[model samples]
Target: MHPHSPDESPAPRPAGSPRSIDPRRLRADDLRYLLAVSRTGRLVTAADALGVDHTTVSRRVAALEKSIGLRLIERGPDGWTLTEIGRAISDSARVIEEAIDRVVDTVEGQDSLSLHGTVRVSAPDGFGTAFATPALVRVRRHHPQLQVELITATRQLALRPSGFDLAVVIGVPAGSRLVTEHLTDYTLGLYACDDYLAKYGRPKSLAELREHPLIFYIESMLQVGDLDIERHLPGMTPAFSSTNVFAQLEATQQGAGIGVLPAFLTQRTQLRRLLPDEIDIRLPITLAVRREAVTHAAVRALWAALRQEVAERADELLLE
Candidate 1:
């Protein structure tokens, strides 16, 4: 026979070895990168968000695609878009991330007050930072043994059960298992920066606001009020709009336009009440807690602290 070539002569296989192939290994980092791409929609954007270079993201994504044997993303003139496989992976990754966060929160909650376990609190983004955060600081001062975690997101925290020990929710609590505590009910009103007020003089009525530039909060769910303009204003074309209340407040402060803000947030800001006498948009505030967590020492402490804080500042927190 001719000299045996390596391809012509098969090497002995190990016992119980797969005759064909094995599934490729998947890693947490791969999942993270994939999720990042899904969120940002482009290699450059994803890389920047992850604090890596575009080429690195591109290379890692390519490797991940090969390992998984599927195309995860598609490129187009508009931007990078996720394929069905990519979307599925992203959803799975989010579940994994939330689970991991919950475990961490639980573990941290076990530490001493200085090292005490962490209590995650969620609220409307603006309210969390401006009001809830300061109140949290006060809570920490009183109970130095507990750690408080604050999560500020515009979206409702209904995705995962018990994701938070306590949440300062706007409107009524929906789930039956949740214990709802009424924090306060207040009206929403149009506000503009002092500078804007000085320049435009405040609009005296709904009809007058039609001529003024309008800034608006782009909430995922809009609950219009009884006032004619208040009900219609969000539907009206906005000159400036943002999902972030803080951004809206900043734009209003910079004299961009009038925005509807909770009376509590506006009270501390330099923005002046516009149409204060005419606009009456009521928004109810409630504190929600999982029934299981109500008796938790940390949760009860926070709930009591928040109640006292809001109670003491009720006049400033509510519309006159």
Candidate 2:
């Protein structure tokens, strides 16, 4: 995500001019560009949302910073992030957006598609396809004009997040700007297919598991600290490592090795669960978004839909 920076810092106040910091100098129209940049993390994307160009987005935000006498944003490697004061300013800017929406609602009439525009979301592959998809579908059905983009990847939430409006992560993320909540707790277990066990011999105990080949995520590429193999199975390692959970499942199904996989994923498979009591691993799913995002109608709708989906289908997320 390339968030444009017209300058490393806000345009410096005119040298010793009588122009004091004044709220009246701030243009109400410019805040929309700042709000769009805050949500999209890229000048181009913000431009698309605002029906303007990237240069215009940069110029407007710079003007906002100058008027407010504070740096509204700083460029990070991934994108631009709001400064502490910038976030505070963003909070007020969100109120303006809400007021504008209210005005539009009064004029256009509150149609079902009043909540339009793209809401980008990110999640792990398995959960994105399984749990999140249902919620996304439900939201789309209600607001047919709303566009939801879900990018599936297993990684730590960014301290300075970009490229997505919302994210569902494996565990709680540590970020001052993020507002997070517990989504659900899901369980994982050691499992082997009938053919796999017949070929490699079933592990009767925890000690026996160490001697067999393990199927799980590749150590080097696995970024989610919660899925660390050593945390759950010390001294044991994956013989067949894969980035994709489905690949690990398939390898186990094809008699490759015992797999430490989510129970929800293996529920319909013929794989045999092993040492349910000793090897049961439970982890939490978390929902996160920047504080400024709460004002967005589409984002709020998607958030409610996801929470409702998880609560209603709680049975599907866990084995026992």
**TM-scores, in order shown?**
0.59, 0.85
lDDT of 2 by residue, 256-279 (tens): 989999888888889999999899
For model 1, residues 10-30, the per-residue Cα lDDT tens digits are 334558764442345556676
Q: Which regions in candidate 2 have their CA more than 4 angstroms from the true location? A: 1-9, 13-25, 51-53, 66-69, 102-108
Error in Å for residue 71 of model 2: 2.4
Deviation in angstroms for 5 in model 1?
Answer: 41
Clashing pairs in 2: none
Q: Please give the RMSD of candidate 2 to the true structure.
A: 3.3
* Residue 260's lDDT in candidate 2: 93
